[model samples]
Target chain A: MINKLRMGAAGAVFAAALAGTPAFAADNADATATAEILESIDVTLVSGTSLDFGAMVVTGAGTVSLDASTGNLDCSDADIVCSGATDIAEFSVDTASDGRTLQINLPSSVNLLRAGGTAGNAADELVLDGFNSDAAYDAVNDEYTLVYDASGTNEFAVAGDLTFDGSEGPGVYNGTFNVSVEYN
Target chain B: MIRLAASRLSCFLACLAAAGTFGIALPVSAQGDLLVAPTRVILDGRRGTEVILSNIGSEEATYRIGIELRRMTSEGQLVEVSREEANELEQAAMRMVRYAPRRITLPPGQPQAVRLSARPAVELPDGEYRVHMSFRAIPKPQPVEEQAEQAQGIKIKLIPIYGVTIPVIIRHGRLQATVALSDPGIVTGEKQKWFQLTMQREGESSTYGEIRVMKRGNSEPVYMVRGVAIYPEVGERRVTLPLSSEQAAALKGPVRIEYREMPEAGGALIAALETAIG
Candidate 1:
């Protein structure tokens, strides 16, 4: 049954193409080419961007935080020495439909562990939590909402607070976190 | 030309930092760019439908598709519930929904369809069942350069994985719901005034639509919010709509707040209330 439908669709396209030619034998053809268009929703991480908390030296352990809305870093703790450039994670959402409501979900927390260290080793990990975003928060929904603009594009930034308990190993740490978006 | 050179210098510095510390060149854009059509799905009958998943990024990507259970909180949050913790209805819903090609790899600008159908048991009760379908991009392991072993400084590489989930709903039999709007008031916050109300829902199904507030005699709505939903799991949902100073002033007298179905759903009125706001 599927093969027959495929043949019929191919035949319809061929007949339509032939009918467009000046030398076609038939004056007209009633071939049908049905198309089902689906609404498009695209989510992309902005190029050349990452949630960088910058390089910091920890003495007695404190918090280094970046504000998602303002791109401001708060490293005022006396024990932490902060340096280098920091960035908030950014994403762009585009949809074919205008004014569509979307939910942006960010991980509540993520752990950055020392490279080459065993998983689940607390000594080698730094905890990052208190994830915040620039998206409008819906108190009713307890989630963030990103409404597509007139052009169907919405961009938002995400930031979080990194904390070290003063016992974390000093090696290079690597980790991954997830962000999700869904239609509301 | 100067701007181009500046960007190049930054890029070089970034590469130098990576080499001097981690000894690996971080990906410029490692996360997958994904697109999914018809973010929400409804299966009211036996006919199956296909969801199109497209890879819009520059590199090929793999996506793992799976069905998960989520329950709606009174506050309107969808919290993930493990299979062991799901209720009988949720378990049944998960068992009935079927989809093929649990995973797929797509090249840039290419799209693949994941077909889904629901098969309710013979004795299944008449109600609405819902599950969330998640499409997550599996992260690829970065290749470690030889110099990675020689680098001394401790560096951190944070990879952000991107994913999306759409609610899939199946209505087995007759389902209906009624909504009511109540407790209309004004809340003055630090930055702005907010219009607050509670939506009470009853019956077996869920209600989703838009809320519009208008002055007693005006044709235009003074305040409007779209894509509001009250799932069956919750009896009432408190909604706080942000209002401009002018809108707050205009809403001082008698106003009408109406909750209607989404425009695509024919814009039928679900609930309405008339009250004065101060």
Candidate 2:
């Protein structure tokens, strides 16, 4: 019985050693495997205010321009009517991923047409030309450095001029343009 | 429609020169202040999802929302694409998406939603489609100065527009992707040492997962990265992750490298490999 026990113990030890050799060898080769991970994200941006260019009256063959900085209006000599209640376009951003920098993209210009009407002539159209924005951006370089504040918010403003031809018809003019935001 | 001359903002500089203190405030280009949520979106037979845009700046802003195309390079950089360059799968993806109110104007401290829905065609081939939604700031116009400058031949407008973009993805029917880690290496260059990982993919569709490196006997990973994407553009991609000196030193022996889905989605183990480094 004693001899049998000793032989069994030797056999067990040898078996354990052999089993360990493969794991050590496996470590020598590069390890490789695959993993499947579902992807999802919860991001949302809310609009709190709308861009108000204010109300304006078109005079004769002159232009009515709005200052982006002061939100003031400048009507040319051909102007017949004018109102000075223009407001700069404003936006505020909120996100769960606070402190991440974002970039804003805006069109260089936009056109305003007489409301519910097509281009009749020069008098039927006006242009919002040359935009000066508060957001730090370089149209040439296409770069931005925008970040949310500690409270998970980032705000910006857009100001542009509204130009009318010498004889813009008397009516409300509306137009639509594009703005894009991205993580820098 | 008003025939507006789309002029750049640089024309305003000339105005400042001519009209000294003309009561017109100049454009004060400050750092961009905008917020967007869920940097990425994945829609798979789910209801419509909403992306929120908020203006965090002190002033009100108008953001024009539009869908743009971007293709991921092997190095994980997104390169913009034009409609003419879109592939068949990419084109199909665009047709399946429907978003409302392309333009949103907001005041300071206000937020707006761009609702998005995926309308896949019946019997559509199983694959992944994506589009990048962008929110850009529309600069206020400087009319009087621009026209005056145009008359004077000083047309140098510098309207700096800034915004953000996020990936909106849709998956249709029986799509599978396999992700693996290989070529584990430690590279030191430019006065920095980084742990480099080679992520490999197989099968159809794309894989978006996180990479984690943990030493033996440690429950937590020493280094981890989320939002690692292995798009269908490449079968293999090499990503370099910066590591502190201490973390690099701790990585001298055997370490377990794991690639898993986002933890929010249960972080299931897709593939794992053992890498021994010195």
Candidate 3:
């Protein structure tokens, strides 16, 4: 009888120990997940030109957004300030027929706004507009005001020269837009 | 032209600063690089473009930069492109052109290809894309064993190759969203600065989506925001949170934007965007 009583007491203690494990594990997982979530960022598009999908934008959300869902980013030589072509977050054009291409190389200087809600974690759209070349620097109000414009669509004239009557030749050409984001 | 692969405007201005014809030498480390000033091109359904290429080498070096499009696996490892299969590619990516310097011998203080070119296509979406270039010395065939022995003593033949590859980007599109800024207008006082965030997306054929952005305790955002989408759109959208007057006043030097991403294309999750806001 004494031995039975000892076994019963031990069983009760063991059951209590088991009962605490789930709560402990859940708390640990929740804490870890919260920490991870705190240190994350999300990126998405807003407005401008047309979204032809020349490049891909990644986000913290759960879904993939396609360029077709977006519009075109429009800016040209008329806007002396570097716009449209220069502020591209990312791209993949190797070079043009004439050996000219553009690229973005920043040594960690700026930050981009991101989406934090659960609505479109799937994806966010981007619009590259509000390009006014008159401003040499990125305008405080505009995100890409300082970006350079080098796309053929702007001042590039990226194909064979067209002639109304006599002009000819110099058909193939290349172009690129370069700009720097220097932070003080 | 000291370094052709560098910025055209910068180089031109530097030349003028040195009194037009007087010469300006570049740092030794800046030599033999095929630098594409603005490493990306954004087209508004347009075609034909140009950029600049230069030999940033301190000494006379030859440049035969090879440009091609390779496939990126889900793991993010680049699959070397085979020239034979280059015949098939996206239509917009067809009209590719680069400085075909059969051999560009740039002097210690000279630049070349003052103007480069590009030809854009009109039928594509707005998102991010990638392309690579190899700027190393072309490998020469090795001599036969007997040919080597026949040469003086031990025919010592060595070819030192040098190259630096760069990724080119193309962003095109329009985006509009209601940004929820922590502060309406980012204001700073007492030698302080704050950070705001934005996002851009290029087009498809891309394989990345999903990212995360966050900061330490302070004013915790109710939801988590993502910095990069495997393929974000090709436009800019604002997502800012105002820094309280107190935080701005106590600010030291820089605000940080630390982010991480898990590319659907495959590979370990890595830091996608890390910028400073001051």
Interface RMSD, all candidates in order, equals 16.9, 27.3, 29.3
Best by lDDT: 1
- Superposed by TM-score, candidate 3 places the C-alpha of residue A173 at a distance from the truth, in angstroms, of 42
| TM-score of each prediction | 0.81, 0.54, 0.32
Runs in model 3 with CA error above 4 Å? A1-184, B1-36, B39-52, B86-92, B96-103, B121-130, B137-156, B170-215, B218-278
lDDT of every model, 2 decimals: 0.72, 0.57, 0.28
lDDT, candidate 2, residue B92? 86
Query: Candidate 2 — which residues are off by over 4 angstroms?
Result: A1-184, B1-32, B143-158, B244-247
DockQ by candidate, in order: 0.22, 0.04, 0.01
Q: What is the TM-score of chain A in candidate 1?
A: 0.79
Model 2 global lDDT (CA atoms, 0 to 1): 0.57
RMSD of 1: 11.3
Worst 10 residues of 2 chain B by lDDT: B1-10
Residue-level lDDT tens digits of model 2 in A71-163: 566654555355434555655543433223345555667766654447756665667666555554433333333444435235666666666
Which of the predicted structures, 1 or 3, would earn the higher DockQ when compared with the native? Answer: 1
